[model samples]
Target: MEEGKEDLETLGEQLYNRIYPSHKEIAGKLTGMLLELPGSVLIQMLQDESVLTGALEKALKALQLEQEPRLTNKNEDEVSVSSDSVGEQLFDLVDVYNTGYSQKITGMLLEQHKDAVLHLLSDPKLLEEQVNLALKTLKEQSVEETDVSDSSDTDDTERLGERLFSLVEQLDVLHANDITGMLLEMDPADLQQMLGDGAMLEAAVRKAQAALKTWN
Candidate 1:
């Protein structure tokens, strides 16, 4: 029975490694699935005080701990790192609006920069084009500004950017008309804050237009 239990645990570990690959954070999910297996089988295995069960629990805990650092590292990396410039950020904001999370972040942005948001939403294609231009400017700039005095402020900005970018990527996955409807309904202030600056706002609109032309 003990040997059989060991075999089961070994199989579970193998399955976990195959599914998660480099991501250890999914260990808890895998464990949850394992626990859902037939109760009778589990009980029968455990009747003899199996060491394999103990090992499995420990392995799951280890995976959780390993995953914690990776998650934290990912969040930290985003704070000081940006793929493009203020222009990219603008397109990213629109991108977020296309996603479900946009409402929350967009509401916050609208509370700060209502006019900009309205301008961007007025024409989705144009906004995307402008964003691409803004991104080009950011890329052209030699010096990257990464220093921030306030940690909280940095975190807030990072969160806003992430939410915005995630939305944009989601929009790219949707139908064009549905994407347009989502943008029209978003708050203007929110759009402005996500754009970060006036230049980015203009660039994003231009980029959107260019992209739309190519798509058509």
Candidate 2:
């Protein structure tokens, strides 16, 4: 029985290490996840208060280490201060994805780290540049997959282009924390024309509404 218990403990430690590279790394990841995941999941994960407390404590310690000054040897006679770590890199990646602007990595991160992605929809720092780049990439890929001909086809192409433009505009406005105002200001005909399907439009509106409620 004692041996079995020891084996279980070892397995747990191994699992923790795989999920988190280090105790400090785990702390930051858990803190970020807790801040982002739904309330119910967060509560369930924290049911054992010690688990939550320990992660927080480790994360705080890691933050302190990150803030502390470090000396670097620039040459035989000179020294400089430098700050760098794997934890910092991981945190930076998380920050980029969680800041609301879309990237190709966003979907991958969302799937792999759903708990750490909850509040992304609310970040206003995500600028139009990122959105434009992502939209441009999508448009280029879409165009490559389809071909257009003359006159009537050209008109259809123009209409499709307009719809793409509208989609990007809507995404930018939504990321800028103006979803409700945008929705209210949008003419029903324009919204329908931009979105093209009533069901999809309604679904998008509901998602925006939910995001707003979460923000509030």
Candidate 3:
């Protein structure tokens, strides 16, 4: 019951975080049935190239990824089960033909740029060397160029808060760490600088961390 539902939500969260977007499509697009299946069965299919049950295959194909290979039966002595991985049959082939890169490459991009890669997945022409440059661009883009007409300290606080929130909304834990490290490495000035107070910036960072958890 209640515990089981909680457990499934946790599993869905973990699976959603660890599974690539494409593999997710291969797994019934995060359907409840996928979560309801035995962990051993899902693990078996993910790890080894096993024949998926009919319901599972149909569920995966419902998403209509480009290269879902026809499934074979284990009982057929003349035909061997698909040696290609469930991921390979679904996502990897699409990776080859569509993106021409692996999830590993995209994952490395995440390590470099946090959740930014999630947006970049649509760009098939992306190159690995361009990752850091994209991050710098995004970081710069976070700093809005608008002029605040109010000359009060309140306007300063609001403006700084807006800039910081803009950055955090795009960040995950890793990218937050990047900002933390950058902040720490820089010298400070006064209460009227960086933000209204150190506590405010700390609160913004915490908000980004909390937001990242929900994104999973």
Score each candidate by Cα lDDT.
0.41, 0.40, 0.40
Deviating ranges (above 4 Å) for candidate 2: 1-132, 148-200
TM-score, every prediction: 0.21, 0.22, 0.22
In lDDT terms, how accurate is model 1?
A: 0.41
After aligning candidate 2 to the native by TM-score, how far in Å is the CA of 66 from where it should be? Answer: 27
What tens digits encode model 2's per-residue C-alpha lDDT throughout 46-147? Answer: 465564554455444544544554433456234321111221222343333233222232322222222233222223223223334444554664465345
- Over 66-169, each residue of candidate 3 has an lDDT whose tens digit, in order, gives 23333245645554322112223223322322222233232234333323433233332343234434434433433432232334433443454345435544
| Preferred candidate (TM-score higher): 1 or 3 | 3
Off by over 4 Å in 3: 1-192
For residues 1-216, could you state the per-residue lDDT of candidate 1 as single tens digits?
Answer: 698678667656654654465446766575444443444444443443453354355445433433433213455646432212222333344442222333333323332233354445444445455545444443333123234232343344445545554555543543232233233334445564644655554455445444443322
Number of clashes recorded per candidate: 28, 0, 0
Residue 12: error of model 2 in Å?
Answer: 61
Return whichever of 1 and 2 wins on TM-score.
2
Give candidate 1's root-mean-square deviation (CA, Å): 19.5
